[model samples]
Target: MIDFHCHLDLYPDALKLLPIVSARNLFTLVVTTSPKAWLATSNVFAGYENIKVALGLHPEIAEQKAGERLLLLSCIPKAKYIGEIGIDGSPKYKETISLQESILNDTLTECERAGGKILSIHSRNASSRVLDLVEKNCRKSTVVLHWFSGSLTEAQRAQDLGCWFSVGPAMLRGANGRSIVASLPINKILPETDGPFTTNRSAPLMPWEAIDIVNTLVPIWGIPKEDVILQIRNNLAALISEENFQQNHSDTK
Candidate 1:
């Protein structure tokens, strides 16, 4: 199984968590949201070979001394993806939005030269501008929007921009989440736990919790649960492959 977005660093018992997952052959794409977690996660996964990591400045921690942020990001040698990065929509988040964009731009440039590194963007209330910057500045590899919350028009724009969409456990409990999953092309979709970040107010997810989320919408997509899970994993490969997603541009005509 492939969990495309999870925070492995947040687990209190990180060492214990892996044995259970490895015995079952579950793999994860871990996203580190801060300089602290970024360092810890990279070391924890070092030599494991089964984990992939994304290092970036998340909106909540986006405002930082520029030198500090860049240095920490560059230190993660295992990092091939950039983000859980992008604008957030709260009054407090507004102050750091510019910092987020600045950090994101420089990271994208570095990723571009580093041979098309992938990204996992998080766009909350700023999907329109997220789409704008992605369309213009993404000379890097594929950019995936994890747990996307936007309109169909925005969704279409995202698809047009070569950004892949991911859905989470929230899809199981509500109309809005289910509707978003129903709207996406199965080929471009990926499944994630957003693990420690996507909890039930009680327990955060382990890797396998992703299974229950996939099972919930099995009938809607008209495929078997096992097949759907397989496709979601397959979609992860496709989305992360980078060769498949080509950035589209409109010329000044």
Candidate 2:
């Protein structure tokens, strides 16, 4: 199973779970909330082939940790994944909206220059603005909207821009989830656990719980479970593979 966005480092027993994540060889993207957090935990899972640690600067704290923006730019070359980044227009974070936009612009610019990067972004209540920045700066990067909560119009716009969306169990159970899922092209949809945040039976989920996400999509798409699993896996491969191709093309020139 592939978890495109998960705060693996935020789990209470993160250290204890590392070995299990590795043993299972689960395809997981471990996103950090800050550059310092990424610096601290990234190397811990370096030996695990299936775990990829992304460098992120979450928007909720973007304005306060402005210094980390430079740190994030400098650290970009060291990792292929970039995320937990983007705008949050929720009421509590409205004050830093401008700062978040600036950070996102810079992040997308860097990703463009790098040829390609996989980003798991958070849009919250600012899907249109987030999509604007993405369209303005992104050239070759693969953008995945994490737990998207936007209208169908904006979603269609995103799809036209080649953006992908990641959904967790909670989203699948949300009021607009069904319409959003139905609106999206099946191939562009990805499963994410967003573990420690999404729950099943009142228990915080693990990265591997992403399997449940795939299972959830099965009936939603009216396809066989195995086909859904295969499609999702292929989608992950295609996402990274396309970027690898772009990076290689840039390198050759």
Q: Using Cα atoms with residue i matched to residue i, what is each candidate's TM-score against the true structure?
A: 0.85, 0.92
Number of the top candidate by TM-score? 2
Estimate every model's Cα lDDT from 0 to 1. Answer: 0.70, 0.83
Report how far off residue 113 is in candidate 2 (Å). 1.4
Residue pairs with backbone overlap in model 1: none
For residues 55-128, what per-residue lDDT tens digits would candidate 2 score against the true structure? 99999999778989899988887779998899999999999999999999988998888887889999999999
lDDT (Cα) of model 2: 0.83
Model 1, global lDDT:
0.70
lDDT digits (tens) for residues 77-98 of candidate 1: 4567666677776687888788
Model 1: runs farther than 4 Å from truth? Answer: 64-67, 72-78, 240-253
- Give lDDT: candidate 1, residue 112: 67
